[model samples]
Target: MYGSQLWNITSLKVRMVYTQWRKADRQVLSVSYMTNCDLLPLIAYNMPLESILDCKYISFYKFIATSANKFVSYTAKSKIFDYTSTLSKNMAHLMHKYELDIYEIVSLSKYKVKDHSYYK
Candidate 1:
């Protein structure tokens, strides 16, 4: 599958593909990798990067950490939806269960994609 198609899939599912891709590239070099530090950049570099910047979850965290004052001031002054806290919580939760099993990750993707009514 293509890079954009992968994004539409849940992160739980993509963990496996990312692992395989990593192993194939001989980049990860670790057996039980958790975070997608290597995977994200690899796919990003290989794929057609239409977006000027990758506005993924990690990028969001870096922005908040690197520009805490500016972010705080802007958020306090602006009327943007305050999903920062919620997103951070969710990211932390996902990080706790990080796995690099490809088959399991694909299963997760299928389950999430099939469960439209759960969110509804």
Candidate 2:
């Protein structure tokens, strides 16, 4: 399958490959897989290992990291509405540091509230 198709299938495989490469410390293997699978760009950004960071994928990493931070902040805010907004502030700082697009990272989605009148 093509890299794009594999990527769309599931992120689990990508994470697994990264984990293996990390445990083995095999840069060659990682590079080979990236090149052979045609996933050089997609895999470049999401690897959590600092040793694997490349200048070519810095922007992609920034996008992923910023979006993740925003997701965490949003989840925290939703679960604890009364709490102070420190999480969001921290996320904003990280986003700024990475020069990430805040609007692109913070996507709002509508959630449906389930009716429970029958239980009453």
Candidate 3:
């Protein structure tokens, strides 16, 4: 999953990757095909691969959100349509989920500015 940060988290393409990961993990663990695919060695109900990929995306966003390069910074705020509209994890929503607001990001930081005036 190299460069997975650039991939759409909710895209169908990602589903394909996930399927492959599940299959590969089962093979590695030598488990029966019927074995629960979502379980980890000691951590049940958590998909570490998915979690890692998500963290990568978040780390990339943080880097670009405060980046000095204009184009790079713009990418932190760019919108991308999901290849599969059925899923809804777009970058903006992801940022909001992780408390990375566009206002704070565009202002070149992660701390929210409080008691600020907003002109209509």
Candidate 4:
């Protein structure tokens, strides 16, 4: 069940990033390349599954923290839909449960995708 949840979360991250990339004015090739770079280590790493799960979750949280506000605002203004506060509360609860500080998670999430070839 845990493995399945991890996979779902990872898939969510990929979908989210791809959606953003498509909407971005940046070069598609460059964005695709960068996304691949960010994802390859997670695909190839040999770390314990639990560690990988945590890393992915932290990365997702960082992504949400950085990007969700703009999206939430736009949707709220245009569609009268607003879920950002609820999402933030849920994230905070998860962070507390995991004993993870937001700043630390954001910092460490950046390096989680580095080469893990030595683990192979």
lDDT (Cα, tens digit) per residue for candidate 4, span 54-86:
455555555655566898544433321233453
**The 10-residue segment with the lowest total lDDT in model 4:** 111-120
lDDT accuracy of residue 88 in candidate 4: 47
- Give candidate 2's whole-model lDDT: 0.36
> CA shift at 74, candidate 3, in angstroms?
4.2
Question: How many residue pairs clash (N, CA or C atoms closer than 3 angstroms) in each of the candidate models, in the order given?
Answer: 2, 0, 0, 0
Q: By lDDT, who's the top model here?
A: 3
**Residue by residue across 7-53, what tens digits does model 3's lDDT show?**
76777888788778777777877776677655653333343565566
TM, every model: 0.26, 0.23, 0.60, 0.35
Give candidate 3 misplaced runs (Cα > 4 Å): 41-47, 78-89, 93-120
* Candidate 2 runs further than 4 Å off: 1-10, 26-99, 102-120
Better structure of 2 and 4 per TM-score: 4
Instruction: Point to the candidate with the largest TM-score.
Output: 3
The TM-score, computed over Cα atoms with residue i paired to residue i, of candidate 3 is 0.60
Candidate 4's C-alpha lDDT? 0.45
Question: Between the candidate structures 1 and 2, which one is better when assessed by lDDT?
Answer: 1
Off by over 4 Å in 1: 1-10, 26-60, 66-86, 94-120
State the lDDT of candidate 1 residue by residue for 1-120, as single tens digits.
Answer: 333322522355555665566555445344345545445445444421211112243334334434559866365324223434544343343333342222232234433422321221
Q: Please give the lDDT score for candidate 3.
A: 0.55
